[model samples]
Structures are given as C-alpha cells and as structure tokens.
Target: MRLLIADDHALILDMLQNFLEQEKDMEIVAANDMQDAISAVSAQPGFDLALLDYDMPGMDKLDGLRRFMENNSAPPVVILSGHAARDVAQRAVSMGARGFLPKSMPAQSLLHAIRFMALGEKYVPVDFLFSSDQADASPAPDGPSATALTARELDVLKALCDGKTNKEIARDLGLREPTIKLHVKTLYRRLGASNRTQAVMIARSWGIY
Candidate 1:
C-alpha cells in the first residue's frame, strides 16, 4: 500500500516510517506539514491512504484535512492526534475523515486501524467513542433490546466495548480469527452499523453492555 504520512514532528515521522516499512508491501511517503502533504499528493497521486497530523502547519484545526480531501478525494484520509477529546474525533469524522487515530494507540492497533480504513471502513478507538462523558450524557432508549444479536454476538460486542481487537477477542473466546470476523460482520448487519465505531455507539444507545 502507498501511504502519505504528514507530521511536523521529525521523530514521529521517523518512527512511523520505520515501523510501517516492516510491512513488506507498504511504501512510506513522508511530509513535514500540510503544505508538504498537498505538494506530495500532487507529485505522487494514487495513494491508498493519507494519515495527517491533526495540528500540522497550514491546517488550523481541520482545515488541512478538508484541503487534502478536496485535492485527493480518492484516497481515504485519516486524522492522527495525541489529544483524546471526543469532540475532536467526532469533528474529524464529520469533516470527511475516514478515521481518527490517537497517537497513544499501540502500534498493532494503529496498523489494524489503518488497514481497516483502507477497506472503506471508518475507524475510531472504541474507548474514545464510548468515553465516560458520552456515556454519562447519553440517554437510554425506552424498551431497548439486544434481541437482534445472538448470544455469541453479544459476547463479541462486549469485547469490542472493552477495546479488544479481533485477534485478542479470538484468543480470549477460544475461537478462530475468522469466526470472530464473521461474528463482527453479523453484529454490523444486525445493528445497522457501517463500522465497528458505529456499532459500538448503537449498542450503547440500546443499553447493551
């Protein structure tokens, strides 16, 4: 996969480049700021995905993300930030970001989220999506039910709420990774969710733990 990564921090850029390069099929294109990112996109089109730092230069707030999307609408763009604020993530999603990834995420999870976004899926950290503030403010729907989900599916949903990945869930439940994926697909269909983040929100609204 061809990726365009824009971050002002040289150290971060180096770290990401080194780690992502370990993926045999991945190619890393680095940019120092939003302007650099735009120029890179122009010079090298057809990037599979773009990971933009939330606070990069020339991008006050989400302007960089907007500009990048306007320039290259084909590749999925993701916002990467150290801030874990729910509003920031929500805003990025609203501004057409395919994913919002916290800088604090584990390397494996970050890689997984990237791959997930490449598959035309939206991604947000499960904990960030269901933060304590949102949970407290969210009103429970009357007569809500989780009847749409089977027993195993409910178990998977709970694991998701706890921020477990497919591999981890498979290990914990003594099931194969493919089986867990099938359960996740079923959960998405039953909950009418487009991605894992949306499914978690729907599950929360229904008072499903």
Candidate 2:
C-alpha cells in the first residue's frame, strides 16, 4: 500500500517512516504539514492512505482532516495526535476520517490500526471506549450544582475542560455529533455561561470537575 504521512514533528515523521519501511509491500511518502500533505496527495493520486497529524500547520484540529477529505480521492485518511481523547477520535471518525491513532500507541497496535484502516474499517482505541464507559458508570462527586447536569452532560463537560472538540465529546459518549452540540448548548444555558472556558470555570468553581 502507498501511504502519505504528514506531521510537523520531524522526529515523529522519521520514526513513522522508518517503522513502516519494515513492511516490504508499503511505500511511504512524507510531508511536514497539511499543505505539503495536500500537494503530495495531489501529485500522487494513487496513494492508498494518508495519516495526518491532528494539530499541524496550515490547519487546526479537524480542519486538516476536512481539507484532506475534500481534496483527496484517497479512502481512509487517518488522524494521528498526541492527545487521544475519546471524543476527539469519535469526532474524527464522524468527519469522514477512517481512523484515529494516538502518538503514544504501541508500534504493533499502530501497525494493526493502519492495516485495519487500509482495509476500509474504522479503528478507534478499545481502551478509549472502555474508559469512556467506565467514566460513565462511575458515581458523580457530591455537589448540589452537579445535579443540574446529567451524567452524560458531565462527561461532555469534562471533555470540554480537557479542550476536546464537540465531535470528540459525542464520540466519547457514543452519541451523535449533533447531540453533543446540543448538550454543550444546554450545558452553557444551565451553567449560565457563554462558552466552553466559562462553563469549565463555573463548573470548577462549583466543585464539579
């Protein structure tokens, strides 16, 4: 398979390239940023897959993911990020990403995810989903204000505090992206806050983490 991998970090880019080189059947093309990734994909239309860094130059967060989806004919463009928040992975999948791989993933698991995505299957870390579920099942801490938010909303809020995008929160909670947006809206209204930062700050003040 011919893969196009883009990341601003040279060490990561080099490490991934060297690791994938062990696969005799895989041909790797490298890029430093989203712009270079787009140009590389444009130049090599036959690329089987593209792995993009979540926070790379020329695009922010999922913007690069959207740009690649719109510009490339390639199937299964995967996202690689240092922050592998469950919601982020889900959001990427919702936005036409084929997979989400954490930078901290074990090499064997990373290879497995890549190969799985190459075969047109979505790959999200099982541990992420499991942890999300566990969090949901855990008891809420004592706080009268906490009662205003549902368990799921609290999940969303915690993700927001972690700087997760809406799609990521939805993915973490196994809800639709639109549903996550609605939750955020309701959360803001309930908290009497204007935005994510305000909501997080208010929640923190209320002893709700």
Q: Report the C-alpha lDDT of model 1 over 60-95, residue by residue, as the tens digit.
A: 888767777888433788989886477778888988
lDDT of 2 by residue, 102-142 (tens): 88889986886687567555666545444534433234334
User: lDDT of all predictions, in order shown?
Assistant: 0.80, 0.78
- Give the Å shift of residue 128 in candidate 2: 2.1
Where does model 2 exceed 4 Å of error? 132-209
- Candidate 1: give its CA RMSD in angstroms: 9.1
TM-score of every candidate: 0.67, 0.62
Candidate 1 minimal-lDDT segment of 10 residues? 135-144
Give residue 51's error in model 1 in angstroms.
Answer: 0.3
CA displacement after TM-score superposition, residue 73 of candidate 1 (Å): 6.1
**What would you estimate as the lDDT of candidate 2?**
0.78
